[model samples]
Target: MQEQEVQRGVLALLQRIAPELEPAQLDGRVALREQVDLDSMDFLRFLISIHEQYAIDIPEADYEKLVSLDDIVAYLRARLPTS
Candidate 1:
């Protein structure tokens, strides 16, 4: 997917995960747990959402690489199979 599409998907999933969240509340450079106020389980669910959406395998060790919206977008963009 394109960068814009990836962005949209991330934001959409964020909304699904936290309906009370506002898009402006997320800082792309900040940790997602900080921005979204997610506990360990919540964060795991968020990661699972991304993995399910993109059909990607995300090992536990690599979770840190997806700490922010920008990070998630960049990671998926680089790893997603080309159509």
Candidate 2:
């Protein structure tokens, strides 16, 4: 998937997890939990949403690598098969 598409997907998932967050407020480089008030459960839900969307298995050990919007986009992009 394209970067913008992945970003939009992340934002949409985040909206479900934290409705109060505005897409414009997200900093690509900042950690999602630091930028938002999402707790551990909320964060897990966000990750699950991403996994569901892409049908990609994100192992628990790699969860830390997806701490930011940029990271999530890149991580998912790399895992997705290029068609």
lDDT of each candidate versus the true structure: 0.85, 0.89
Total backbone clashes of candidate 1, pairs 3 or more residues apart or in separate chains: 0
Q: Model 2 Cα displacement at 67 (Å)?
A: 1.0
* TM-score attained by model 1: 0.89
For residues 1-77, write the lDDT of model 2, one tens digit per residue. Answer: 77898789889999998999889988999988899999999999988988888899999999878888899899988
TM-score of each: 0.89, 0.94
Query: Distance (Å) between predicted and true CA of 17, model 2?
Result: 0.4
Deviation in Å, model 1, residue 27 alpha carbon: 1.6
lDDT of 1: 0.85
| C-alpha-based local distance difference test score of model 2 | 0.89
Worst 10 residues of 2 by lDDT: 1-10
Give me candidate 2's TM-score against the actual structure: 0.94
